[model samples]
Target: MSKPKSIQVFEYSTLICGQEYNGHHFKKAHFNALVKLNEIHKGNYFTIGVNKITFKNYVGVLQVDGLVIEILPKIDQYESDSESSKIKWQAALIEMLRVTKRLKIKEKDEASVATQSKHLLDIYFEWFLAEVQKLIHQGLIKQYYKETSQVKALKGKLEFAGHIAKNVVHKERFYATHQVYDKDHLLHQVLFCALEIIASLTKGSYLYSTCKKVQLDFPEVKTIKVSAKTFEQIPHDRKTAPYETALAIARIIILNFAPNVKTGSENMLALLFDMNVLWEQYILVRLQRAQEKKGFTIIGQNSKPFWQNIAIRPDIVLSKGENENYIIDTKWKNIDQSKPSTQDLRQMYVYNEYWNSKKAMLLYPTNAISSEINEKDFVAFQETPNVKDHHQCSLGKISIFKEGRLDEEIGNTILKWFETSKNE
Candidate 1:
């Protein structure tokens, strides 16, 4: 069998069948699979049009049978389709995920993989395999599980009813419930299930051999059906803590995997994430790490009741000393010269009043291809006639990339901006 055809598109881009897109056609099977996948996700990943599928804010790789759709982030809309642009955004997305603890990759392993040209999904597969290998090297943990079966020599408690029912014909066998201690338990079962999935999806990829080798080392545990709730119910302690990272990745792969069993041609696996939520998380993590040394407290999604049974939460709240507080809300989109939306402004205003913050700002990522809006001064709301104090909001932009690499100093840069604005 030949290798699957792969195509790349940025988030919010459209793909249609026939010769509409660079002579590449989107097969009806693939489109149908995406539609079904969207249905499974409640239509959050993409929107289906007449004959085309337009991706939404979610960015990641989606595999539908023989077609792999690599959806890159449209951080810089101008050069979104360029090869270099895709690599840059891919690296940025992966780095952000690492910082946010979504993807667990050590610094040395990440440095080695950073130089290679690989799809985001493949990179994830490799990372998961690496983690599983580590666990295997350290030895899989074992636990006691109950098993019920017929045995020639009864070693455990015999099931009287079952023995009477089954062994009535075969008097030599005993039906018994026994406790077996081994590596074939829930944790390993989940890992094995995910490995089966990876084996099916990663054919012809470079990571296939490594994945298969890892599977050989892994115990052949009983396969069990798992859901999001199944993962949530998994108990963690010193014995099972090492399985956390591998199990997390397995949950992602197993939950998103949609197998078309009838025809076996429409199977799809979607590992997409919302860029908006990612931006918020990335900002929070960066600020938390950077502000720790500055003697400032950074809180994320701090919520307060707004009205009856309603609450409001700002993205980030910076607190220093006793009475100084600042609010920063990160937006994933780029707003060049346009004024911040009235709804956002009003939200920030409320955040200030409720949090008793001295200042608030709408933080945005600067366009990678161009400089951001020049305004740095805060725009104050119209004060009431006799009010003793007023609140202010500003449009803040932080450069996302510097010299073709992710700017690690973004947190410090934002902190500098806050200090400068406060002094003025």
Candidate 2:
């Protein structure tokens, strides 16, 4: 007897439609993968709307019972019909992470070589774990607590409420209040939460040993379930500086983590991110840095009045002095090869009108067709297509893409764009 050809294992980066996933291997893994994805999304690092799409194809970065499957993205207006686009997905993801300021880059982490590996998902997970470990080595931050519990012997003070009733006969129960070492503390809980999730997700000995060591140090501490509200309860001070890095990583992990519902089932987590938000943040951070260097201010998510008592928020606004400003809205989608989208142009028109500026930009990710906008100038205007007469503002598409030097290239591009304001 031999294995059936139809029962082949799904390879890494494999693409399949929802209809084709009715087989045994996919069926067994489907529910669990969805569960893990939902769990991982709790961290707020990214979001996955698995329930939103019913019959469409998905690009896979899924794991189920040691089986990995990736769904390829469908062809789009800016995308080529070739299969190589799926291979380049890892590069796109790495590029996005490269611009993020929250995740510190380490030379030894080998992030530069992510393009060569199909296991990018695992690599990111390992990177996160390593960062957490490094922060832990700086000595885990601790907080004082006024702990009160019943003990066999005296510790702090006797609780009259409990000791009077329970110890009325033998007087054995002792209610005590004393600061004791335990895990419910936020710092220890963060480590414990990460340890638990990492223990289930990876089998690496280093991470496992680190987790065990943390458990030993905080022997009484337990995993404290965290949420957005949990962060609000945590206070920041001098002792918490080292915890900042670990706290950021911990928040991401804890937010995305989902415990297994059934006994012995695999846990779930999601790494899906909103490309729109990521792109906006990247542009905002770089633009702010550029503006600050030139003694200017960059305000993000600037809101303005619209018709019908409505309001609109432009993504990024660069200002020199109080009144003179430039508006830029970043779109994560690909640009139209011939011209910018009418809707995008109209949106910028509103931004320009509200800001009382003659120029506005609709920024998009780089496509196959490169625009003439360079890092030194960063702006090139085109006449609005439908504007037969006086156009409200000059609308243009600025490409923000990854090049050799991301930070320097992007910073220069932003600075150059703002420089045009001097002529206006």
Candidate 3:
């Protein structure tokens, strides 16, 4: 029997691509997870009442301390030819990792992989640890820092106040900056904390032992958890370029590393990433890459006031010049087969009118089972008589199931828009 405390409940939704438990059969299971989660969050985060659980537009993982509950897409059993539900989720995650320049890990044979049983966190942990280990083997970067301290014996300068206060004045207080080299630097501190956390949480895994062995050399380095503010304090230079990737990975780990809770005799730690936000970031990254090759400028979330001086911020605005541009809003949800939602179209319409652009687009993730909505669905917006300057809208679908295609698909979609705008 599975421990009720360890169980996590998530509702199935088309917007996400994964499997979850739902309905009355798992009511007790859901309650158990929520009870523990609420306690961990101190009744602040997940305070909503759960009468009937149903996941909707949100496609992300929610975690309270060590217990994580992932919300993913429901399986489409009827569509046998469709890609495996897990494959779509993994592909999206892999694309996210690549786009962020976090890691270049590609999805290998999913059908017969030993890591098939591993969780998403495990995959990321393994990758981060491996990168850190490789960097360690090359030898941890060292830098010199000035050190000053009071000593029994005079090494440099003697303090007059200390000599008078001591009475004997045998021991001298020295004020001097001595250059020293060791693993007690800021970069080493972050790495050591990340490795320690991973080692503690992931015992028995290959990474646990590896981290233990690798961290042995840095005995003097004190482990310290870091936050966003911590990064601002850390010194960065061109010489530390090689440690950049490791530092970035370590920063994320430290920021998300939760406090451990005592559960029986063991301890629990949880770390989670918001997939919806990550997906948006991933899209922006791919769009930026496309911009580089195509020689176009794309502004993200720029505050542009509309009619009545109301402030508006659209996701992405692709511009050819001052006036020639199109509005793009990325929807992490799967579009319905029949048509785009009224609210989304209206939102885009507002953007188009305000920006003086004739075109707007709604981008969605395409899977094998997703219905292919055509250009006709956007005809209503184009046919509006009040609309001028060849006003139009488009529903674009990019395949998220196929590995390593996110960048290409998004680039192509934007390029096509550019072409269409030029013709107009």
Candidate 4:
């Protein structure tokens, strides 16, 4: 069964900025996540000693070591010096302190040290941030909440005397900086950063939650438990794992640099399948020229790998006119020709057989790891002494291309790949 939503490992955050700090309001997702963690912990309270919180729902008295989230009256001390000032103030804030066993609200504030405050919300947010900086030496909170002296109250030995009041305003402005959260919520910042890492690790190839919340917040997430057996299905040998292969397929557009407006997820997937084409010096030039003169057109899938047992997809299949076809794939990992497993050879061979037109290729990131298909890997195309080839071999004839140039250089190269290659 799925776990409960509230306690599930989630990206969380909160905001605390006021006009005084910057006449601004802001939200911090990272900050909120920390608060959520503290709330979910089961044992001793995470001491944010000496912090105070002032929220409409509570008057968090900042003690030396703990925070207490509770309600307090709006009345302020008109007389900060009279003997009854301390008692009267406590009496006014007492109703907010009464918390029993049945309440189910966001865990209200509970701090170790607080002076007192008029604005309850400010008190709470400050106390929360204070808990975040929990070293007795930090003294940011204890140093901040100095009491107001007026004497005549009781806490047994800890007699109440001062009527301390300090304003905790954000140093930064809370204007347009935090307006988005007030209007639409900006929690996505934390979620996006986290997901970006996952997407790279997964090669932009993991199952996502179809539900909006799940999809947006966790794009590279998979619910399945990864095991040794399941892990064995993917390429475990080189940098040619399924994800790298998949990513290679996804970036087919780079081959010719002509943007194809993919309509749906399915079309996008199909286009990626066509990206695996043999890279040839001539084909690269042809692709570049075609795009420069006339925008390139889409062709069918050309992911031919006579080397593997399973079907592999290329990112794009470029066409010069209605009948011509050339393939392209993206590679995010290092590409090396040596130490390749037999499976890699077999997969490329299979790709060649299935596509049948001629030419199969493997692509990879040259920046990450320097790799090249040495000239020796190339053999004379069966019947022709003049034509040469590589062992990432093909049924008809295959070419290989690794983009080691900048965008303009690669872009020009792809245009040429389209212009000169024979139409399939």
Question: Which candidate tops TM-score?
Answer: 1
Model 1 stretches astray by more than 4 angstroms: 1-4, 20-24, 106-116, 260-266, 368-376
Which residue runs does candidate 4 get wrong by more than 4 Å? Answer: 1-295, 299-312, 321-323, 336-341, 368-406, 415-424
lDDT of each: 0.80, 0.55, 0.58, 0.29
What is the Cα-based TM-score of model 3?
0.72
Clash list (residue pairs), candidate 3: 16-73, 17-73, 18-73, 66-269, 66-270
Q: Candidate 1 has what TM-score?
A: 0.92
> Using alpha carbons, what is the TM-score of model 2?
0.72
Q: Which ten residues in a row have the lowest lDDT in candidate 4?
A: 4-13
59-143 per-residue lDDT for model 4 (tens digits): 2221110111222222222224332433333332322221211111132322211233222222222332222223112321111
Q: Estimate each model's TM-score.
A: 0.92, 0.72, 0.72, 0.25
How many clashes (backbone atoms < 3 Å, residues ≥3 apart in a chain or on different chains) does model 1 have?
A: 0
Rank by lDDT (best first): 1, 3, 2, 4
Model 4: per-residue Cα lDDT at residue 10: 6
Worst 10 residues of 1 by lDDT: 367-376
